[model samples]
Target: MSSTPVRPATSRPGAARAAGWVAPLCWVAVLLDGFDLVVVGTVIPTLTQPEEFALTGTGATAVITIGLVGMMVGALTIGTLTDLVGRRKALIGAVAAFSLLTLLCAFAPNALVFGILRFLAGLGLGGCLPTAIAMVNEFTRSGRSGRATTTIMTGYHVGAVATAALAIVVIPSLGWRWMFVIGAAPALVLVPLMLARLPESASYLLAAGRRAEAEDVARRHGLELESPPDRAAARSGGAGAGGAAATVRSLFTDGHARNTLAIGVTSFMGLLLVYGLNNWLPTIMREAGYELGRSLAFLLVLNVGAVVGLLVAGAFADRVGSRLAGMIWFASGAVFLALLSVRLPTAGLYLMCFLTGCFVFSAQVLVYAFTSANNPPHVRATALGWSAGAGRIGAIVGPVITGALVTAGIAFPWGFYVFAVVGALGAVALSVTRAVRPAG
Candidate 1:
């Protein structure tokens, strides 16, 4: 195994050029994740219309919850799979699985089948995020994992934003099935690009005992290949099981258990905020008296804020440390969300939605970045996947709670207040986890 560390790109122009593919390709991969996050929300209004699919509120909520359950299952399993197989293979396979399943969703004849298809697709798409984040962190310049992590995360919201915008057009004109068709369409290009152009993580290759491949990747990508102490048995409790199982077990020992638990809770809260709003913001707004177009517009605005937040949060995390940055982001999100409980003018509402987005969504990404920065390479994806898997619990709950609120016609201020509290709790959870030194 080898240790591949990246130095600043500016000093090595050639290295910068060589390593350029890591961020962009990973960004595209995460973009697909963003699409999945909001696609159901985007089409739900039409699905529930009596003239169309006519799904009941419970049915809609079930669709959203079931998909999240699949994501939870996927996140928990994929990390282990990535450690055993390889990041490249895990990511590429995940994308392929999701794309095919998502395409099938467009052809579902009933709500039950549609929800089932979504759950299956969620199994694949859920893996995309942690895998992509872990892979990007491995290739980034030292001390810049935050930037790389957040930069790629912007793609998630970009996909969300694009899906919402598409909903404004596609849902009304072409019908809701087209949204799934369009969502699946990207895999055709993304899968081939990933196979042809995406290199496996040098850190992953090294950890897997493929030194030659790791070295080759590092050199090709202008990474400086060094070595860690012991290079094999040094970090994460001597690689107990020597695969995904070992990695997961190591997190429970070696003083890692506390941080893992805290991060999981924080991720849960962060994702609760993210999924709750993404899945229900349009309906929530519409229930608040806004028309459908304006309601969907708010969803787009929220994600646009998310893109901005990711840009700001990453650089901020790089400077202040991911933990502090995450805590601050969660707290700030809480404030913004609390303020949203009060009625505002149209412009004020958009600004608040944008501001709420900035903090709420990026707070979760910061948790991923924090996980990446603190964990040993061999267990990084597993840790991230664990955090995300726990958060999937929150994701499932968020939409269900909000959907219930919407169904009862009480989602507006109450929903925002609920989110605000969740954000505050997330901050408290993050505050409990301090950094640790890699095992020697």
Candidate 2:
């Protein structure tokens, strides 16, 4: 219906054309996800205004933490569901779930109601990124995976930047509730498009022994199917039960367990920094003496830097391994985050915010990259799902701690320093994971 044919394989005559559309479509979905993810933060400053929402510090922080906790559950539960079901179905379901809940958030009667709805919305939101990342990685050529992922992920920053702009335009005119209302709008637009246009992951189909379906997808997309290799053939040589068991077992066999734990820890720290800063940056900066306008502007600048960082890291990760690049990028993030604590001129603060955004936003992305690289094709989704799921614990902790500190009268500089420590811990966790290799 959309004029784009579905080419499922990596190398077909029409593969490029089909991929051209697929990548952008997936990116758009991710953009919507990012938009909803950061929209609350964009609206937070307005929400905290006594005349507006009259939200207390503790109440505000509790709402954010509750949403993140919901996201944590969503990430773990939905991620595994993606492996069991198909990526396409799982993704659509997630979008629908989050969208409905976002609509609920727009009309919440109080902070308590808002917090609960946001939490439900967050579960859907949490499931989206890892599933999209896994789907994109599987769809692209091995060598091009990093670029494809990063390019797509740029949509996330773009969405964040857009939310900041929208906040400036919409919040003043329509009120903060309109922000959540806008967040729900995308689900309406995207869900129908996804159901009609998005295709099942070829890898998923093949793994499920749905060859006819796989072939149909490839034919529609004009892609070539790789001949079943010796490894695949041997694995399937036995009954389907053996192959399924072998796939699960291989995830832990051959030294993958240590790598799994390392990736989990790294993801934990990376998300801690990401969610901590993203959720609290405006509040932190406002307490640091910035006006509401200036604080929101800081968020825009940070996301601009995030766009740059994702592009740079994606290009670099392809050349050096994702592991090394992630380590370097995260280490750089730590340096910049630490630097943000120092009182600087207004211009200097903006510059530091930009630099911090560059490294901090992409650091979490690198965790996804590392998860993809460490696991074999069969268990890749599971690995990413569990890693991201585990990481949500840190995500939950970051905002709670930061908000508590703010409530306790901790200085902005010290709050940032605490985030910097988390970044450093991420660097160490990722570095330890460097030796992990995919199971053969």
Candidate 3:
């Protein structure tokens, strides 16, 4: 019997440009998604005023939680679908769905109706990040994945920063509804570009037995084609498994259970800190004795720190291990978060806010780096999707907790301290997980 010829795992040079463009494009899409997701939080303070929207505290929290619930469902359902359909298609569909729903939010008659629209919008928003990350992961070369993913994620922060700034100017004159209107506009621009320029994942096509299409994509991007390998071998090479069942099974069988749980937990805590702060920072600052205008300015400053952190993390993680770098970052974040509870002088508070921003947000991206590195190709999408899906649960919880704290008359410093504790817990979880490296 003749053996099938084996292809060497050599680097393909032609994919560099394609890979470069793919990361930035995916980044922009996710950035817009992040902007819309957080804009509601930035506007909540205005919405809650009796003279403005007049929403009660608990009612407002309910609205935020409803959107999160929708996002959780969206992440799980759309994540699975990304495996069945292609990432590009799923992403385009998700963006369009959310875009229209956001427009609906602009016209919502009451708080309940607005909440429902936001939840539905959350469904589409939930799918965008994981799908975009998966696309970027597939396009990047080995050893460069962390940098590529983080670089792309910087767009997310940039979007948030832009939204906060825009909200300051626009919300004052145009009203909160205009924010949704503006949010919806990006989908119109992005959808067509994605359809025209976004290529399907080469690995997904190969797994689905569409070698011709896969090869065409690879050739267009300057990759060479090899015969598709068996399922197990393809998975081992990091060609992601396409089906839901197969992807889940891969996580448990190959010394991955521990790693999976670790990623889930770390992601949980990271997101808890992220959503808790992002959702309540402005409100919390207002309660902490800052004026409304200064509170919104703090939001911009926080995101500016986020952008700086994301830019630096990849280089540091590449030098050290991602796990180690993530642990240190989370630890620093915890420290800064706790310190925010104390009333620093004005300049000191701003400095601390910048420092906190630098580490807190990127710590979550490091979780993505860990997920991408731990799983092989076939199960990579599934692993990332599940991680993100789990993290969304924490995201849902963070805002609710902050809302409750505010309702209870807890000082903003105390609320910040609570967030700091979550960050500390995350640092601990990630530290333990780092000890056991998965076989790639």
Candidate 4:
């Protein structure tokens, strides 16, 4: 039924061509996840208009928090499932499921229905980040894990930035609902491409004892199989990854328990900053007396900084190690976040937002890079999943806390103070952990 010939290991160009697509495909999936991060924030201004959803700040928080709860569950479950089932299937299913649910969000009858759709859509969206991050890391050359993880994550902020820009044009003309429609449209193409072309991780295949399949995948992609020295342990750990419960247990039993707790706390604070700011910054700025369009621009500026931060942090982490980089970045984020409380001039505010964006988002991502560096292949997804899942709880709390502040009319400067403290906590968490070689 197919005319494609199997390329041999010597086919360098074919291998390069084959190996390169993985990052782009996974990037777009992450971009969609990025879109989710900002699309709600983009629309909140419009939704609060009396003619629109008439959403109070409290209602907005409820919808956003419920969605995050779904992501928490999805991250915990899908991250483990990806390890057990195979990255390819789990990713495809996640993209398709999220796309379909996002499309349904366009027609939600009221805030209640809209919130429900968001929760359902979040299940798939939550899985996308950990899955994409883990997939890209496995394919990367070693020592480049920081850059690889950060590079792929640019898609996330790219999506957020693009959504902010699109909202400016689309929301004024088409209405708030069109954002969801546009967001889901990419998945139609992304899913089919992933289905037809995306290769399974060779690591997963080998872990499952499908050596022939693993070797073929490795050979075609111009990758070497695990050498005998390290292969035994990778395989042994992977073998136990067969069941989700057992795989989770492996995380605690190895020297990983401390790293797990540390990563969990760091991820919690990291995501709390990420979701808190991205989802609520526009509202926060608006309450501080910025007009609607200017408030939206703050969202764009923040994520543009995120893109720059990812590029810089990735390279920086590679040089200094992820843990050390994370400490500096989180501490820096706290400084900038705390500085936002000062009533700066317009240009100064924009510059601070840009700088804040740079460190704040990447600070969380560095935690992910650290996680990838510390865990072995078999339990990597589970570790990433649980880490991200734990972060989702923070994501929920960030929005709810800010929304309550907004409701009380005290969100602006006080919100920044709370966020600054969270950033400090993250730095503290990472400071406690000494680096370890990845588990077998």
- The model with the greatest lDDT is 4
The parts of candidate 1 lying over 4 Å away from their true place are 1-15, 49-53, 228-242, 282-294, 407-412
lDDT digits (tens) for residues 1-440 of candidate 4:
00111222444777867877899999999999888887887787787888878899688877767888888988998988887778888899989989999999889878889899998889988888888888888787778889999999999988877887899899889998999999999987999899888888876666555668877887778766643224433343343334677778777876788889889999999998988887667778778776643455677788889999999999999999999999999999999999988877889889999999999999999999999777877777888999999999898888778878988999888999999999999999999876877642
- Model 1 lDDT, residue 430, Cα: 98
lDDT of 1 by residue, 122-196 (tens): 999889989999888887778888888999999988887787778878876898999889988888888898888
Candidate 4 stretches greater than 4 Å from native: 1-11, 44-56, 228-242, 283-294
Ranked by TM-score, the better of candidates 3 and 4 is 4
What's model 1's lDDT at 363?
96
| TM-score ranking of the models | 1, 4, 3, 2
Give lDDT for model 4: 0.83
Best by TM-score: 1
Give per-residue lDDT, candidate 4, residue 118: 91
Better-scoring candidate (TM-score), 1 or 2: 1
Cα lDDT of all candidates, in order? 0.82, 0.75, 0.76, 0.83
Q: How many residue pairs clash in each candidate?
A: 0, 2, 6, 0
> What is the Å distance of residue 350 in model 2 from its true position?
1.7
Worst 10 residues of 2 by lDDT: 1-10
Clashing pairs in 2: 6-221, 7-221
Q: List the residue pairs that clash in candidate 1.
A: none
Give candidate 4's root-mean-square deviation (CA, Å).
4.7
